[model samples]
Target: MLDAGICNYVAISYGHSGLWGGGMRQLLFNTRPSEACFGHFGAVGRYALAAQRGMHEFSSGPETWKHIAMGQRKWANLNPAAIMHAKPMSEADYHGAPLVVEPFRLFDSCQMNDGGRAIIVTSAERARDLKHRPVLIMGMGQHNPSNEIAQARYLAGPTGAHKAGRAAFAMAGIGLDDVDACQIYDCFTYTVEITMQEYGFFGRGEGENWFQGGTIEPGGTMPVNTSGGQLSEAYFMGLTPIAEAVMQLMGRCGPRQLGPETRTREPQVILCSDNGGALQSHSCLIFGRG
Candidate 1:
């Protein structure tokens, strides 16, 4: 369309009924006798098991996942639109939750939600005259290691985020120190941990320390998922993070806005991530104030 100048804008819209419509259960697994012999586990169980086995090298145990869960839950409390806004979570509440898989608790997994989100894409000059201030896209990169998660060599550590983040930052011409906030895709708490490690937010195998003491929570050194993320907010897949980043850069987030007063620094630059196919596919986008 841009080639012919038929349209200068593109709109992306998505909606899913994986939660209330009952699509979540039968989508990834079945209870047939033959399938049951291997495992009747669904996406949650399968991903949880994979993460448990794959993350053993960096994580000491399942306890570390709580930090990610509780941190995002805190952000949810600040967002009235978040599904879990009214329900606050504490360390005790997290640990007391029953395990869906061996190492993942109810809080550690994202709540399947039926939600829709839409975004508009246009040229920088066009956006300047739009309704809101333009949110500039600084850089974007993608790295898909493998289509099959089980076959991915870096399934546990150094995910596709490693190369993808490097490319995005290099394209942006900025270092990690310039990043003010993050919008990490959090289908599961462990997803955030692994992605951030590979993004070079901290040293490899040091997530247990980097995630502690509210580092990624609201008002922390690096605020992440200020919209509460897919874990506490609504699950719109990759769009959840992208939408939040757009709102934040435009200074449209009401209660969970990241400003110099609310966060360690004003959100001049933001980082967003989207993961697909069991972390085998990764995409990074760097956004800056426009």
Candidate 2:
């Protein structure tokens, strides 16, 4: 069951993005199973974008690209250990980066880094025997939208995220109100913005407003991306969010940990999301302590 859940999330997040017009597609097409396909997409997208725009290229994509780049810069400002820390680039610096794919600059794309993470799952009864408290997979949900990316009604909205969220809530027998914290994937800033709406954390097009209010910061209302996310943290396919969820539940996230100041309780419920393609696919899961 756990393998199946991982497969579904990976397919929605990494599989679709692999289809983008670049070497990522080639890597995915050559890989086996959906999870492996998605893993290669991140690595290939980084190399392809870097090669196309020249090693010096920094900014990438449209105006929204700049917005997300700036967001990452802000997060980096708070995280001194970040690879890109103390190196926030200005819009002019963004413009100076060689153009990779028209709008995508070097900084616009997620950095390709090396890292590995793991999680252990067991029945609530069996969890007591483990080294740490077990974070129950209280509610789990997955979704896949139509394959016709061109015909999809909302290019910017995460239709799959909405569907996956509903399914997860139903499985967990909980409502959005029960969620305490979130670890939604932030492969791109627009993705985080759109997902905030799709997950019903904010209204449509209101995600940017939520971001502006600092609701996603460590002590903010939602406390999102506590691990720096794909934006400020390392890119490890869609698995990074899974690790963050585990950390949140285990109370092991150091400075990124969301306290009572940010949340009413140590996060008992965590909502994690994964995005693939041109925001074409999504997957969600809700975790809690057993």
Candidate number of the best lDDT = 1
The C-alpha lDDT values of all candidates are 0.83, 0.61
Candidate 2: tens digits of C-alpha lDDT, residues 22-76: 5544533444445355553333343343223322232222453455555555555
TM-scores of the models, in the order given:
0.93, 0.69
lDDT tens string, model 1, 1-290? 75468899999887888776765656445445654677745557556755776566665355667888888998899899999999999889999999777677888788777778998988888899999989988998899888654466775767889999999999999989999999998988888888888889887678788888999887799998998899999888789999999999898988788885466576899999998867778999999988
Model 2 spans > 4 angstroms off: 1-82, 85-107, 260-265
What is the alpha-carbon lDDT for the whole of candidate 1?
Answer: 0.83
Which 10-residue span in candidate 1 carries the lowest summed lDDT? 26-35
Provide C-alpha RMSD values for all models, in order: 2.1, 8.5
